[model samples]
Target: MNAALLIGLSLQLSSCSNDFLEEETYGEVKPSEMTQAANVERAIISAYSVLNGQIDGASNAFNSPDSNWSFGDVTSDDCYKGGGGTGDQNNIHQMEIFNANSTTIDIVRKWMALYEGVKRSNEAMRLLNASTDFDPALKLKRAAELRFLRGHYYFELKKIYNRIPYIDETANTVADYAKSNTIFTSEELWGKIEDDFKLAYTDLPEIQTDKGRPTKIAAKAYLVKCYVFEKKWQLAYDASTEIMSSSYGLLSDFQQVFLPENDNNKEIIFAVQHSINDGQASSYNGSIGDRLTAPGGPFYAQYGFHRPSKNLVNAFKTNSVGLPQEDNIDVLNSDKVDPRLDITVGRPGIPYKDLGVLYSTTWARDLATYGEFAPKKRIVSAKSPFYVTVWPYVNALNYYIIRYAEVILWRAEASVEINKLEEARALVNQIRQRASNSTYVKTLDGTANAGNYNISTYTLPWTNSIEATAAVHTETRLELAMEGHRFFNLVRWGEVDSVMKTYLAVEKTRRTHLTNAFFTKGKNEYFPIPQSYIDGFAPGIITQNSGY
Candidate 1:
């Protein structure tokens, strides 16, 4: 295809169309027409565009349309589907109660968006391989990028739905995707994803000229994450060691990592890039999805969703030495807490960004149903330059997929598994120390510290590997709270059933919405594959996950 036509196709892919599994052919520009190097480059850009799935409008509900927030945070113990009530986004409410079925809209939407991403990546590889005229070196680099993206989409699919159709560049028609056993075994699927990342790691450059593009280091980090998920301790450690040797390191201030000015900084290994006032019909380039998570009042009026849960807030409680008070809830109100809690959550008396007063309970739309807390990580201040008045509540802040602190924690986990407890403690300490330095959130008058912030690193030796591993997991939860990693971490560590069941029992007393919540061990681990995928195509071919 010519460059303009290729760009047009990319725009079509990014539209809010719901037709996902169907193949829409652009007038076939044969291999001969795409001989120019620029056309090949445009084709690669088209593949990247699919990363931001369909943007329907400037609605906060679909801001990160393909994100895991609904499943990763709301379904876990960290958050609630904060809105008008259980009737608001009722499908998400079903998911929160562990009752979401295959026909649920959220499941269908997420499934289609991810499959569309897979299709676009496959198309890009097919077009790139067809062209015989582009520079061989450039072709290799583009191929590696596409492979990384394909692996990423599949990884998301594998996590959400254990059995998914693996469509590569060779699957050219709907029939191919409809074939029986298109769903490979779990081991085979992970292997496919691992191979793709390995290729990207070997071929990608150390850095990229553009800010949003992935690098060899990013690929290495992703590979480590893959190994960590599979419990392959030695492989995870080796890959993490390589990433730590790179130029990236933790940002000195933990709060700065989320601010708009510090986007794509040394701390972030890879993130979804966002831009404000891009002149698109909708401000879809910004992170409008999280706009509702901000406190609503005369200051910032918006939909209030994804409110932080009371259980998550309580987990931040720290003791005199700055370690978690795991068994004591009575100590929370009076004892010192982790400094990162003030940065991650908005409580009744903490300052609400640069907008002057302390966040009040009145900010929540229905405090009786959800809670008195708000999410603060992805929110932007009204006075910040990243704030765009055109899309009043929307701000162009990037969402991190992986950061350096996460890499440190992953390395720590791997070390504990490999019997290197001291190394693991040191890695966890690095994250805690940075959080301790991030204790700048104060009262509106700036005269007193917010919520008695206090955090200290692990100084005593771990008694055993189990204790060391538990410490690493708790640190991970504190460091990466509300960033859509909680449920996934729980699942990988085999702690979801116990952790969530207890969470529901305790939280039901505070928030009545979760009174009926229960998490089954085997079935609740992955969401049901959408029923539309089974009924619409290949009736008996696509099997459903258990207890759907």
Candidate 2:
């Protein structure tokens, strides 16, 4: 099971009847009391465990996945909430249509799960600081690791909630977490997340003998991402160039990026490691939250909730010379498209996952509402040992939180913003070069290419920053489509208003469910703070985002 054993053995907290910010402990030994060397290490492992976003007693894991699929992908022009029908997990459907509110169970659970991560991180650091027998050098590394993880948890929270209670090791119990989301300004909160990453970059080793631990390069990569979100183009470019110069680069094939064999391969900067058959009867140690995407037909499991949209599929279209087409044209099955499209989305006749089974249009659970294509990432082969046939249809494939390609794209974006057009074009071309050389999806007999796989790199230098920025953005959407990054990327770029309006206007003509779906400009930029948490405190004790 590799590092999955850590999650299986890591200590977990019991859910209190109140908000997740308030947690009660179990047993006689408090986190401070367990200051032995081995226990301190155990606490470190526990901090990493929550990154997978699995709550022991929570059944609706889709409400809060570490992948950010629902919050990031489905809400944008990337995908749709495809299930048996619209009523299935309607809260997410509401979110998909931008009808979100403070009490969305999905939003509530996401808040709970993120806070649980903060809780574990605080507990682990407490143990580390309290430990009297642990090795000093190892304790420093472990503490840095916990800081990176807690920074990660808070980063996701900030992206989703905009303003969140930034808890750290200083807090211990439920009473200690009475701090409000208003204690720090938005800039200050960003600084706190940045500070953790900076300290982690200072202390963490360049390489780890273990899996899932953040290395110095990983911390730097996260710093680049934080800078990207804050629009600090110079800082993003500087930090991202350092990572690009490091050992990380694109894999020869894009498909290999998500393969189980390359779970923590050289390309992956950080990921929440998943494992199956780990002796957990529920198999929650695996990619439990992503089980709904299994697009079942013959041997595959049957939820099929995260189906790719027609808009996203058309985005893969390539011109005759192999470049992204202008958005005005409609793409067809016979169109000359990018090679990465077939590898990304499952078309009607393309072989799914290189398996002998040809993907049938009927594989889509709800064709009338959602499109025919299903998510191909995060899915493993049926013959693999990691695939488990259970209610969740879980697998051991690790969900990549950050990969080298993303860092490259971030740098490209930063370069374009800083007027380094040629450098940005070269950066985008680097990713495209991998896609052009990479393998395409196989046919039914595995004798030939599945579709018209035509993709090429930028042969011309970009002289215009505006066009160059568009190209970089398009390259990112094509390379990282359906990986739960589209919406957040759009939001950070401040293009959600224009893009969603155009997308909803056109998409409603195809999918009837989006007829009334709309995105309110400033308000929809972020979700509302969960009402329950606000109710638990005084009127001004906790602050809520505007337009809630």
Candidate 3:
């Protein structure tokens, strides 16, 4: 009922705790009572809680992780699906290889989790709209927050499944739920999603006391992302301009930005707040989806999933005076590269964090299959109070969905598309300059720099839009690597076909699993709709994607 209790509710929602729903109850607050302010806040918390992608009955929440690790990272050239073996979580491996079909379990489960968030958000909005007992002004703000959440869930659904149903607060009945995925055109769906965020921008406050609540700035940033995905360059730039004028800016230290202690720092506009040992049963409040992402080094749990690829490792290579070498023939260890590489990945012989233990090949779980590199950014220090060393090794580190730096790059991208090449270059230079200023990771003895760090910002002019565009895209890949944005970035830019072709060509030689790998651009651009859900409804409720 109080603020503190509401914060706890946001961290862990009891409404979503059941492993299996009993026949007698739906395990939800009664819709009639949801009109009360106390219940409204609780309902809102329930919606926010699902953003972490922790479904109790779902065996592996990683299938539906809000972070999009499987769909975004493994699907891209950035990572390999490293786990127990080839057969382990094979649904994801199917996605990794672009061999997935409609029945793929990962696709189904991700669809379910995203739709669940949409349902919870819709329920909150319905209650807020129906409530006369609540303060009118506060009710509007709360509804805007729920709408923003709805926009996010819909955004994820739209990205993965392009022709999804646009269900809203009014669709309460069983028959209403049967609305066709084709009810609206793809453009219309984008408009509806934009409408939600636009409303949230108008109503939500500039600041919120709740750690994970969407402020006006957060809504505006999401707008920029939506525009960028839609390729509406002018709209994206205008929104990003407002965000730039705001107080949000980069943190001085790049390495410190990802640490748990800086979870909700100024640099991060929005993130899914993970809480360990919270009141939730079974510690599901922690990093359920990301638990497997921990690289199996000493002072860290040993799952060794989400291994960084050699292609990604080589991508860090820089020429003399700190410029990127786009397909450089440089060995990983001996080459000079960006300092951010050491912070983002754990290679053999580099000190893993500040734990005083050097990362070794022994830490790698299937080194022959996945290579020696492991994911470093997602894993927190074992000594951190937020870490849980239990079976799944869940932690309390928040996954950033939108950071200020991301918006800057998005703005840079928009500027280039609008022929503002010089503007885009300046924006990208901001990101590179920060990377140059950030501290380099140290060796095990703390006496020397880890790897050959020599990253710096561009001093030369981006002569044309093509060059500027390439620079921005490359910077985006380097700046946001391993954060589950790579594949989507390739998709939005229409470069997946060429990029993946080049990646698979070389990667097949390195790893045998990729020997037969290929990406069919049109067919692979978006995943097919889950067949089971379509079957649950009428014959024409949901149409499959082309070539499915």
* Candidate that scores best on TM-score: 3
Q: What ranges in model 1 sit over 4 Å off?
A: 1-11, 15-36, 55-67, 181-183, 328-333, 389-392
lDDT by residue (tens digit), candidate 1, 93-208: 89999988998877776676676667667777887898778789978888999888888888888888878878778876555566553557888889999999999988899988
Runs in model 3 lying further than 4 Å from the true structure: 1-32, 328-330
Task: Score each candidate by Cα lDDT.
Answer: 0.77, 0.82, 0.82
Regions more than 4 Å wrong, model 2: 1-33, 173-175, 537-539
- Candidate 2 or 1, higher lDDT: 2
Give the TM-score of each candidate. 0.92, 0.94, 0.94
Error of 3 at 441 (Å): 0.3
Query: lDDT (0-100) at residue 545 of candidate 2?
Result: 85
lDDT by residue (1-548, candidate 2, tens digit) is: 11222212224532211121122232235645588887666666666766767766554677888788899999999999998878988998999999989999888888878877777787778778988999999989988998898899899999999988776787645545667888899899999999999999999999987777889999999999999999999999999877988988788888888888778888999888777766554667778778787887887877888888889888998888889985735667678888888888888888887567888888888789887888886678877887887666888888888999999999999999999999998999999999998877877777888888788888888998888989999999988898889999999998999999999989998999887799998889898988877785324677878888
Error of 1 at 228 (Å): 0.8
